[model samples]
Target: MEALYATTTGLLAACGVYLTLRGRTFPVVVGLTLLSYSVNLFLFSMGGLAMHGNPAVVGAGTPAADPLPQALVLTAIVIGFAMTAFVVILAMRARGDLGSDHVNGNRLDVSREDGK
Candidate 1:
């Protein structure tokens, strides 16, 4: 279970970074969101996977997962939401101002060079 989470989290982060570098606003925004999810998953995994139980409660002979990681994950989730919202709004504003959705500045100027 732990290995699964680690692999999943790593894949998310890798994909997010790749998408973020693409030459488009939508992909960049999506990548940002994916990255946030990856971060949350990574933090959550640190608390360990439980079977429909709270990490704060320890069972007989079994120690409960660390509470600090759980707390950190919660905080990260909230912050991630805010960050995603901000990035989305910024993308929208950029698209509106530039009148072009493409990330390449040269693409925007091509029309001027062609006199069209």
Candidate 2:
């Protein structure tokens, strides 16, 4: 289970990075979202992979799960959602104003003599 979880997290991170390096805005946004998801998974795993552990309450038993990582991941999720939304809006506005979705506001396929 641990190996599977690690592999999944690594895969997500790798894909996210690859997409982020692309030349388009949509893929960049998706990549960032994937990266955030991977980070959340990592943070959640830090609290341990207890399958049936009790919550960390006042009178919990020995196998109580740590609540800090859970809380942190929850907070991160909310923040990531908001950030993603904002980025999408910004990308849309950029596309509209620049007439292109490329990250640099210029189509790469079109050749330019000045090499801008």
Candidate 3:
């Protein structure tokens, strides 16, 4: 299970990086999201994948999963969502202002047509 989890996280991070290197805004945004997801998963896994474990508040004999990672992951998820939204909005604004979605520059046709 640990090996599988590690492999999955690595794959996600690799794919995210590959996509992030593309010359477009959308792919970069998606890549960032994927990378964030992989990080979240890794952080969550650090809390241990206990089977049939009780809550941390339980006082019984059996071990309980660590709650810190879960809480951190939850906070990360919310922050990631907000960050993604802000970045996407910024990208759209840039696209609208620049008349193109390309990260580097607008296409010749678009530039010529827009008289930019």
Candidate 4:
């Protein structure tokens, strides 16, 4: 299970990075989301798969998954949402300012860049 998770995490991350380097705003945002999901899964897996477990507050007689990773995943989730929102808003603003959704190589944005 751990190996499976690792493989999945790697594949998704690689794909996300590849897609993220594209010129379109949509694919890049989607790739970012995919990468974030992989990161979350990777972190979650670090806690180890639990079987017959209890909360850490109970100390003995029970195996418990690490709470630290869980907490981190929770925090990352919220932060990731905020990041996605910010990226999306930036995409929109770039679209409005340059009248195209492409990233660095967009015609209008490129023309503007040439002026600088």
TM-score on alpha carbons, each prediction: 0.77, 0.90, 0.85, 0.82
Give one digit per residue, the lDDT tens place, for model 3 in 1-116.
88889999999999999989987789999999999999999999998887788888756766789999999999999999999999999889989888888887568855665687
RMSD of each candidate?
3.9, 3.4, 3.8, 4.6
For model 4, residues 5-69, the per-residue Cα lDDT tens digits are 78999999998999899877989999999999999988888878776768777547566778899
Which of candidates 3 and 4 is the stronger one according to TM-score?
Answer: 3
Q: After superposition, how far is residue 64 of candidate 4 from its true place, in Å?
A: 0.8
- Sort by TM-score, best first: what order? 2, 3, 4, 1
The lDDT ranking, best first, is 2, 3, 4, 1
* Higher-scoring candidate on lDDT, 1 or 3: 3
| Residue pairs in clash, model 2 | none
TM-score, prediction 4: 0.82
Top-lDDT candidate index: 2
Clashing pairs in 4: none
Off by over 4 Å in 4: 108-116
Which lDDT value does model 1 have at 2?
Answer: 75
Score candidate 3 by lDDT: 0.89
Model 4, residue 113: C-alpha shift (Å):
19
Count of clashes in candidate 4: 0
